[model samples]
Each structure stands twice: as structure tokens, then as C-alpha cells.
Target: MSVVDAWRPETAAGGFTRDDEDVAFYTRINALIHSDMVVVDLGAGRGSRYDEGSAPFRKSFFNLQGRVKQLIGVDVDPAVLEHPYLDEALVTEPGARLPLADQSVDMIISEWVLEHVEHPQEFGAEVQRVLKPGGWFCAITPNKWGYVGIANRIIPEKVKNALMRRVWPDRPDMDVFPTYYRLNTLARTRRMFGDGAWEHCSYSANGTPKYHGNRSFGFALVGLFQTFVPSLMRTNLFVFIRRTA
Candidate 1:
């Protein structure tokens, strides 16, 4: 569920696009974080984040010890115990409540996780519950209105899982979950965060046809989606939020 961060254009022969604006957006958020911050990584896998992939919690600059007070990883799979980037890990039920105390987390980050949430409304409330007043939230998830998204919405889950297994066998099935895409659009984000009184720091659409290895149909569809469609139709959505007092 990772995309290339390189700034490749949608109109290029490679049929891929990159929205580096997300990197810049994250840079701003990174500057706001301090060494004493208590960060929670929602749905963080076994630290599979990489260069082409987003960094662990999408914060490469703060990866070292003492860079941040803590980075807690929460996942549905116990394999999260293998997460190297985490100071602590918590395994939870799929779509169940978070285990953290109320108003405890200073920051919350989700990398490609918002899409798979079974119930985003309740989940958003949970996020607000765990985050302290004035706390920050940032995330990267696929745009459900994008090219790959349209295809995914139409394709059956079983078919999609089969495709994923064939396309990305190295990635475990536990890493993949049913995508809801409830928070995929700009309007949807506004309704979710704005209604909760969360301050909107920034938001953007990022990435391109990196899915399916830039194959023919996906490449063509995503290229067109990146070019002709609006930003909401891009491959990924980058959102930054701040909880209000």
C-alpha cells in the first residue's frame, strides 16, 4: 500500500504521477514535533516502511532514539512485535477500540490505514479521544475516488485479495484489510474532522500508478485519473489535523 515519493509527472510516458506536496506538508508537521512527544502509529505494520514506501510513521527524520520520546505502534496482528521502529507495540482487535488512555497521545499518525477502517465515524471519535487537546494527527491513505480506487470499489474483495497475493506475495495477508474509503475525499475529511472541531492544518492528494506495478490497464486508468481528474482523484490523500481545546 506504499507509493513512490519521487516527483514523476502524470503525463510522462511512464504513466505515473507524484505529489511531492505531501512530503513538504509532512516536513512542516515534523518541524512542529519535539523530542518529548508521545506518538502513536495506528495500523503500523512490522516496520515495513522504506524509501519508496513512506518512512516509519512517515517520519524518517525522527527515527532515532531521543528524537521523539516514544513511537508506539498499534496493529491488529501480533507480528507487530517485530516492528523495529517502535518503542512499544500494542495488538488490538480489527476495528475494535484503541487501548490508550484518554488524552494521552501527543500525536497520531496513520500510513495507508484510514482506508481499511471498518467504521470511520466511530474511529475518528476514538482518535479525538486518545489525542490531547491541541494534539496533531497526520495520515496517508489511498484516494477512493482515484483510478485504482474506482477499480477497487468495483472489484470483489476476494478478487482483490487474489490480485494482491499474485501482485505482492512478499506482503502478508494480515497486512491487507477490507478498505472502507470513508475518509477518502476532501469533503469527507472536512465533514469528519471539521465537525469534530479538529483544526485542519493541511491536506493533499499524492502518488500515482504505483499500484499493480504500473501495469497496462492500471497505468492507463491512473494516468488519466491523475491528469484529467481533480486532486481528489489522485492515488493517495495526505491529511494533517490538530485537535482543538
Candidate 2:
């Protein structure tokens, strides 16, 4: 068996095997989904989960098509137009306003997208403006204070692309983008959204050192070491907030 298959379960909670960051992220958003809600997928690309060749069981949680009234996809990349799950796909420019009317969407979900946001204030303004009153915006992103974020910020984009190609060959080069950690940290993000307009909650999560070249024994060893890292500097941040204004 591959390293992920053999070692992931050992690191998972209660050795369930299937539990991981993706499961946690999708589960949190899935619970918030309702049949009548219009959901916007911010920075949605061409249905990347499907491209990753995940099993049906794994992909099931990531799929968010018919469960909502409408699943609108907005992305700076035109590849979003090909998103299989989107009811409507609109192309947008970086730092440009979203095409939807103000308060039109009931929920917005961004996965691995915030790290690429160069203009956070403009992005936050669009998120707040597009969501209906009391709308929810949930996102999963790399924590700027974490090892991954630190390395990402320090490394050149070309080097990152090459390293990612070596470590995760399955992921396409087109999916990679330059990262700016301006909105990645807990303090900065909280400040950007502010307290009066949004009710927020955020937490950090850590998983196996998958970037360590797919070796099972090495992965297990590093995974154990990862447990001792402070919670605040964990690999990823899951943010959930409701628009209060």
C-alpha cells in the first residue's frame, strides 16, 4: 500500500482512517447548507476535487451541487466556467467586485483560496456585500503563522511550483497560484472583518507531513512530532462567521 493509505489511518482520530482535514472542512460547511440557500463558491476552480481522482466516498462530502438552491461559482480564473458543480459560473478579476448583486447569496465557502488573495480588503468587502443579511462565510486556509505558511511566504512561487510538482504529482500546475498571507492570520483576519459586522470563530488543525515525499515510516515519525507543535501554529485554519449586519 502507499504511504497515505497505510499511515494516514494510524494518525487519524481513533484510527478511523477516513478522517482528515478535508473531512473536517467539508463536514462543517455541509451542516450549514440548506435546500433554500444560494451558495457562492469563492475562487472555485474547475471542480478540483474531481480532478484529484479521490474515491466516490471521499468526493461525496466535497460535492455541493444540488443540496443548495443555487451553487454559484466565482473565480479569477476562467476555468471556473467549467466547474461541474456550479449552477452559474462567473469570471472575475483579482481585486474586482463580484458580479452578483448585494446581499444575493445566502452562504459563501472558500477552500484554499484566501492564501492567494492579494487584495484582502477588496475581497472582504465583496464577501460582505454579496452575502445576504445573516449569511455565513466559511473558509479553510493555511495559517500564516504555521510552518506551511512560513515556508510558503519565504519560498519563491517558481520554487514552490517545482517542489509541489515533486511532492504532489497528482495536482496540476494550473491549480497553483502565488500566495500572499495578508488575510491568513487569526488577528489580521479578525481585524479585517471586524467585530461589529460579523460573528466569527476560528481554530487550527494539523495533519501528517504529507509534503515529506510520501514515505510511510517518515510520515509517521513526522506526524508524531507534529502533535507537539503549539495549537496556534498548526497547519491550517478553519474560519466560520455569520454576517451580523
Candidate 3:
């Protein structure tokens, strides 16, 4: 089954609510938006979750009616390409060679996807190959050093794999897909881009401590920690990189 067919939007799994936190977070990374740029959103999950009413996932696309030259949304799951804002959509395997032409795209954005990709180095290389000189790439993934990573390490591999299957039983076929942060560290990310291929702007996100049913106190506390020791927080990792010619 396709990834989309496996994971249906569970409103109970924290519905898509863009509060002050989301606005500020997205704004920082999307500040490089331009009208003439060919923007590509990778791993663009079911666009419905965020495109409610008219609010675009990237705040910069909010007022870009005629301004946007083209917007392409690509994902392994074909069901996620039904966004009104998308000029085109492509279904492709994750971590494999993207179907886009080399250096054809001006900007790329990905959210919560890198962690699930088994070969992130290849993925990063593909992003570098597809982006034009000076193009920007923004991505978000879970951090491996944060509290969640700690928890994952403590759990046995067998148990963790079982839990993942339970949480996403719909896609039992993809149960082998690596979950959680894998190749996501400041040093590792820099290396993936090669020597002087790109520059990092900022990397920050909230973390998760304990996952006790729906209680989010631990998650909230980790967010507070991000305010201070930003590097230590574990929930997510947001990165902005500009391609260098």
C-alpha cells in the first residue's frame, strides 16, 4: 500500500492548528520566498491538513496569487498532491533520484521527512543536484540527540519496531522504512552537503521528553529547553541551506 493509504489524517493525533508557534517557526525558514522562483515542496503530506481555507503551509505563499511562477508538490504518497496551490504534482520513491531536471528548481522545502529516509546522504545530494546555483533548501526532521532519541535508544529494537507497526498498521508493507532521526546532526548535515556546497542558516525545533498517551507536559518542557539550550531540544530539526556555486 502507498504511504498515504497507510497513514490517514488523525485529527485526534493533534489536528493541524497553526498557532503563534507555527507561524513564527515557518516564517523564519520561508523568508527567502520569491515570486519568480520555482518552489518545490518535498514530502508534502496530504495538503488538506494545512491548506485549510486558504492558508498555505509556507506563509510566504499566503499572498502569492499571481506572483508565484510555479509550485510543485512531490511525495512518495500520491494522495498528498491534491492541493489547490500546487501547479503540478509528482509521485516518486523517497531517497531515490528525484524525477526533476538537474538545477531546474529554485527553492525546495521538506518537513518531517529526513528521519524516515534510509539514505539521507543520497537525498541531500539529490537536493543539491536539483537546485540551481544560490537556490535555497529548507528541511525539518526529528533530532536524534533529543529526549525522543534517548527514549528510542532505551527501547529494544524489536519493541520499537513493533510499536511503529502498531502506530501505523495501515502501511504494514513499509514497516521496514527507518523511522525517527537517523542522519541528522549539525556536523553530519554539513558533511552531507559536501565542501562549501551549501551554508546553514539556523536549526531549531521543539523536543519531546515522555510520550504518555496525550499528556504533553514533557513535550512542553522540552520546548522551554529549546528556548535556552536550543541544540539539546529533541522533537524536530529545522534547517535552511543556500546552495553555493
Write one digit per residue (lDDT tens) for candidate 3, span 1-245.
32221222332234323222344445764577767888887876556434444333343433333555787888888775665557888889866789899999998887667777777778888998999999988876667776566656578888876775554443435224456565666666777875777878756566322242223443355446655764665466677789988
lDDT of each: 0.72, 0.83, 0.64
Candidate 2: TM-score? 0.92
Clashing pairs in 1: none
Q: Looking at candidate 2, what is the lDDT of residue 96?
A: 90
Tell me the spans in candidate 2 whose CA falls farther than 4 Å from its real position: 9-19
Off by over 4 Å in 1: 1-26, 50-65, 165-174, 212-221
Candidate 3: clashing pairs of residues = 207-235
- Per-residue accuracy of model 1 over 1-245 as CA lDDT, tens digit each: 12332334442433223444445545665777888999998887777654344534444553533567988999897877888778899999976789899999999988778888878888888898999998988887777887667767888878977876655556755566677777777678778878666888555554544554434555555556577677666666677889987
Sort all candidates by lDDT, best to worst: 2, 1, 3
Clashes of each: 0, 0, 1
Question: What would the TM-score be for candidate 1 when compared with the true structure?
Answer: 0.78
Candidate order by decreasing TM-score: 2, 1, 3
Residue-by-residue lDDT tens digits, candidate 2, 62-112: 888889999999999999988887899999888998999999999999989
Per-candidate TM-scores read 0.78, 0.92, 0.71
